[model samples]
Target: MLTAVGVPAVVLLAAGADAQRPVEKPAAAVVAEAPPCCMELVAPAPAAFSAGSAAGGRIEWVASSRASVREARALPAGVAPEQGLQVKTILVARAVSAIFPEIQSIGGVRPDALRWHPDGLAIDVMIPNPGTAEGIALGNQIVAFALKNADRFALQDCIWRGIYFTPGGARAGGYGHYDHVHITTKGGGYPTGGEVYYR
Candidate 1:
């Protein structure tokens, strides 16, 4: 009787040990179940700017002066040809010109030797008497238009009178942007540290 009881006890102990042992899973199966840590997902590019979707009104390209083009070409290296009064810049300038026909002067794609310019993504529209009530109102209207229709133009940011607006919101800080509204596009690529107007 004692031997039989001891045998049963040993069998139960063996069963418990087997239950505690971890089962080995196939390496391939384990890997198949886990997602890669560095997996990359591609996103589609944003819609291209079109006349039908342009803000303010229809876009019309304004010819750039030979001097302007020459100056842009002479800018420092790494600046692409498009960055200097090219297609993208012309598009933006034309759009604004259509919206504000009263705007006598518009500047686009001027290479800044001291600061970074968005290759083909930036334009400057001069505000008439920027310090006065009318000028501020016009600036506000333009800023509002840009912010409201940012997707239409692929605008990344706009700066006016020391204030800058991104899709996120508005902040204050910029140099020599008081008289003109400065607009930048995401398509031109981001600015380097030195290119940023606001610290």
Candidate 2:
């Protein structure tokens, strides 16, 4: 029964009252965007931006929910079971944040991008120093982090221009294998049998 807490005295329909209207799922929030210049992650970021590094470098965007927030919300008190996907997305964001703290700007990417790709665990970032040697090194480190942590969570795909790895946990059908690396986490993370992409 839904209750309107307004001045008008209202009653929620009896426990099994017919729903007044079809429940509408809230639109998924636009979290982040990936840019062409950024690179994948392998491990945690270096403590200090290499002094040798310059401004406007490549970056990875991170959404707020790609972490473990999903498990808790899976059965939210007021939410219906049908919201699993949304809940799962929230989890992915939480997991990503847990696994990758270097990602800081997922929301910078606009909804309308030149090439918009959607990956469950991916958060887009804008790297300004992509053209510099430091940028290249930065990208390599991130890729290494992603490869190590694939098993930590389920990932739809990891798309690095040169080459990419995919977790064998789920989405092994390889639907977009040719287009991108499909990765799914076994909850704990992707640990082995993963491939590496290189330039």
Candidate 3:
């Protein structure tokens, strides 16, 4: 994991000024600031597994009850939220965007009162022509990535093609979510804060 740090300014004195007076110049240091809401670029996480199978790419549980460890507001730096996702969800969106260029939009924060959507902790990774073979393949890859990096993104659950994936493993049944991959973070519906990491 990468950490952000600040630089210090430097002071230089001119040689041979006056006997009592000297010229001093200060050089300011430049520091890169992370965007508001703990937004930072992250390298792709190391793969936990190579394939997506019941026995191949099972997600290991490494989740947090609270998504953010520090106080943050608004979305990540470049992530565009569909509805109104929480900070942690936006971080996941940003990670997906960085990893998968084919993905265009992500849906967040809905009116569903019974689930994580309305709380802004869930996201729908929209897929184009999801019924097609290519689309399914891409969704599977994404699901596999999510499962592998469950700890990095603080993921709680991932659902694709009506199949649910947790750190425990994958299970099938139910309906809907065929057009997009649904993912939820650790937080329940409530105000979220803190930093989010991609890897």
Candidate 4:
């Protein structure tokens, strides 16, 4: 049974409950208008993606589950912690942060010489407790989410846990992607609103 918390807006789902809800126009509007909240509800991306180990010479793609969060709820707006990021980049960063509250720090527009960061096209989602098992799992989920929503976000690539993921496929051995997930997006105009979604 679904139990109501002190706030009507907050409902704690039972363990293992499939919290996925049908996408509604009102929910989309809420996501667009709601102020960024770290405790916003998020649904794990359904379906799986192909992945391969970095050690292999020929990448043998295998199916990997994308769902990670325990339950689903309406997606809320997100905040951009770092500055100097593109408008599209900011929107995506906000979406990611709202989807994953564990991610507290997001780095953007750094002086990486000629890299994507210097061009304000990249954002780093730093993983908390990166050495722990939970951290690894979170990183995996974030990567999966990014890959799943690549076209919607105009994502170029996502690197995490030594693996590089694109809309097409994923390959391991991405250097320096241990503690954080790196996401790069193609150039795009500012979002008019309701561009991000959990489903």
Candidate 5:
């Protein structure tokens, strides 16, 4: 885990410019902005497990509830609703789906055996061909979008193609992230004010 810090600006003063001149001070420090989303450029990792098994079984395709459908519609275009998804997860899923409709599915909530999946704060968008050029481009685009709008989306962390992003930085690690972009939220829902988990 990493914490967010403020970035300071330095001001260099000329030596002996004027005896009585006042020196200007910098404004309040700004929170350190995260580096560009795609910091590591490694080749997409090979899938280590079957997508179905990783997601815990065949994805359920039932119609979304009225509220869930409405939340999905609130997202950007090209988002296909997944049944039984929580509202917050649906919002996160739609954000990625809006960027890449080619995603085979967006998974929410793992089976009982997988404890890593948070009840409603996480989502996994499946990319069928991560090694292909198109797949790579789509992955990059999704990451870039997430980084650009991390605050708006209340993103706590994101992982894909063996790379993960935190408010502190993006680094390479994790297995089975090759076939999907996994996103986790900060507060289990939209954050109010400056509430961010990674920060």
Candidate 6:
């Protein structure tokens, strides 16, 4: 009824065999676990092509193509294709990081999704917490920056801009962007631009 640190060879062999048994998920649950790939990354798009960009620097749909619309790239800041991470995306990320160091290190202001927004520019800036003061401030900054540089960044859609959260409804500088903020510019849907759905 007792097993010592050093067990008989036979007992140890049996125990080891039992340990090797593999565990499997329930058939029904297993199917649900691996969901199909609904979203995918595409090539970078141009600023002039998409419509996700807003008017006068407001955020809007990514493109006329409903499919592409969702895949719009939220611009970060500058444009550099060679770098794995786009320059614009990195710039915007850096901007937010500077304003809020805590969140940035913990992973905030990075796009939940990013690509060619099809509105005008490319890359989507995804704000992780689209509902907090920090999130709001970040969102506001994105909108303001795009607007200020309308001529340069091409200022695509700022969909996460007008989101309005109650005094404490969510907690954001913009509207219901607490969940996640989407900042699209112009670029490929594939490979992504790092933008989260804010509203």
Which candidate number maximizes TM-score? Answer: 4
Each prediction's number of clashing residue pairs: 1, 46, 1, 0, 0, 67
The residue-by-residue lDDT of candidate 2 on 1-199, one tens digit each, is 1113212111111211111211222112111111111113322332233322222221122211122111011111111111222222333333333333444423211233432222222333333354555444334443443444443334444433344445432222323322222223333322242211110
Candidate 3 per-residue lDDT, tens place, 38-58, comes to: 222222343232223213222
Clashing pairs in 1: 83-119
lDDT of candidate model 5 versus the reference: 0.46
The local distance difference test score of each candidate is 0.45, 0.28, 0.54, 0.56, 0.46, 0.34
Q: What does candidate 4's lDDT look like per residue over 1-199, in tens digits?
A: 1123222222222222232222222311211221222222232433221223222212222111222223333334454454556655775687677667668888888787666887778888989997677776677666666665565568898887776778787676736788888889884744454333331
Q: Say which candidate scores most in lDDT.
A: 4
Write one digit per residue (lDDT tens) for candidate 5, span 83-124. 444444555566555445567687776664544364566777
Error of 2 at 17 (Å): 48
Q: Which is superior by lDDT, 5 or 6?
A: 5
TM-score of each: 0.49, 0.31, 0.56, 0.56, 0.50, 0.31
What local lDDT score does residue 133 receive in model 3, on the 0 to 100 scale?
72
lDDT of 5 at 89: 51
| Candidate 2 residue 149 C-alpha distance from true site, Å | 1.3
> Which ten contiguous residues of candidate 4 have the minimum total lDDT?
27-36
Error of 1 at 82 (Å): 9.4
RMSD after CA superposition, every candidate? 27.9, 21.8, 20.8, 17.2, 20.9, 22.8
Q: Model 4 scores what on Cα lDDT?
A: 0.56
